[model samples]
Target: MTNSELAVKAVIDTWNQTIARFDSILDKLTDEQLENEVAPGKNRGVYILGHMVAVHDRLMPLLGFGPQSYPELDEVFLTSPDKAKATPPIATLRTQWKEVNANLAKYYAQLSADDWFGKHTAVTADDFAKEPHRNKFNVLVSRTNHLSYHFGQLILMK
Candidate 1:
């Protein structure tokens, strides 16, 4: 395969691996454990889960796919900090996580190497022309780092 194809596969693989790590971690934690804070006076496991779901949901629109599946999550998980608003149940958040990622995976599979290199919805054409690095692939790479950051925090619960 070409270098661009290889690059796309590498990022996609890393993304899937990160998702799997979260799935494994989440599966082991009970709802009661999810109630505990990741650190003293810090965000709770439930809040983090909801936060991730909210963030990932927005990726759809940001990447020019469509509207979010769970815009409601933004208020509780994104706009507000932990305990600022009530979050969905652990079970519900877990389900939403699976659904959102699965949908994104389908969308990812549909992209060509050129599509991955194209600007996402958040960028204007002029800005993209000036800053070609601000593309869809960069978003995924940054988000993978975001997820990995949370993964480190979340694992503290175990």
Candidate 2:
């Protein structure tokens, strides 16, 4: 494979591994446990989970897949801080998390190495021409770091 293809594979693999780590941690926690704050006066497990789901769902439209499957989550999870608005049930958030990631995986699978370098919806054509690094693949790289950051916080709950 070309260097570009290998680079894309490496990023995709890291993203998937980070996702699996979250799944493993979530699988072990109960609804009540998820309600507890990760730290004193800090965000709860449910809040983090919902936040992650909301962020990943937005990636759908950001990457040109389609509109978010759960735009309602934006108010509670994305725009607001923990407890700023009522969140959905842990069960519902869990389902949404899996569904959003699964759908995104499908879209990711469809992209070729060249496609990964294509401009995402958020960037203008003129800007993309000038700043080629702001591509779909860059979004995945940043979100992978985002996921890993929260995953570290989530681990504290266990």
Candidate 3:
């Protein structure tokens, strides 16, 4: 395979691993545990879950997909900190997480290697021509890192 294809595959593998770890962590938590703070007086598990959902929801536009379905998630989970007016229940966020990840997986599975390397939502085509590294693949890499960071924090809830 080409080097670009190899790199893309590696990124997808890493992202899939991260998702598995996150789900494993979530699977062990009870609803009561999900309400507990990772650290005392800090963000709760529910807040973290909602925050991730909001962040991943934003990835759609960046990846050349349509807009997010959960704009309100931005205000409660993204703009504000935890205890932000009672984030969604664990069950609800879990449902959203599964659906969002499923849709994102479907979209990513359809992209050509070239499309993976192409400019994401923000950059103009001319700009992308100049700076090709700012692409959709990098977004997935960065988001994977973001998820891993939160996964560690969430794991502390148990």
Best by lDDT: 2
Per-candidate TM equals: 0.97, 0.98, 0.94
**Candidate 2 lDDT by residue in tens digits, 19-108:** 999999999999999999999999999999999999999999999999889999999988889998987889999999999999999999
lDDT of 1: 0.93
Q: Give the lDDT of residue 75 in candidate 1.
A: 89
By summed lDDT, the worst window of 10 consecutive residues in model 3 runs over 81-90
Per-residue alpha-carbon lDDT of model 1 for 45-73, expressed as tens digits?
99999999999999999999989999998
Q: Supply candidate 1's per-residue lDDT for 13.
A: 94
Evaluate residue 139 in candidate 1 and report its C-alpha lDDT on the 0 to 100 scale.
Answer: 98
Off by over 4 Å in 2: none
Task: Enumerate residue pairs that collide in model 3.
Answer: none
How would you order the candidates by lDDT, starting with the best? 2, 1, 3
TM-score, cand. 3:
0.94
Selected candidate, larger lDDT, 1 vs 2 = 2
lDDT of all the models against the reference?
Answer: 0.93, 0.95, 0.87
Q: lDDT, candidate 1, residue 68?
A: 95
Candidate 3 regions exceeding 4 Å error are none
Question: Which candidate, 1 or 3, would have the higher lDDT against the true structure?
Answer: 1
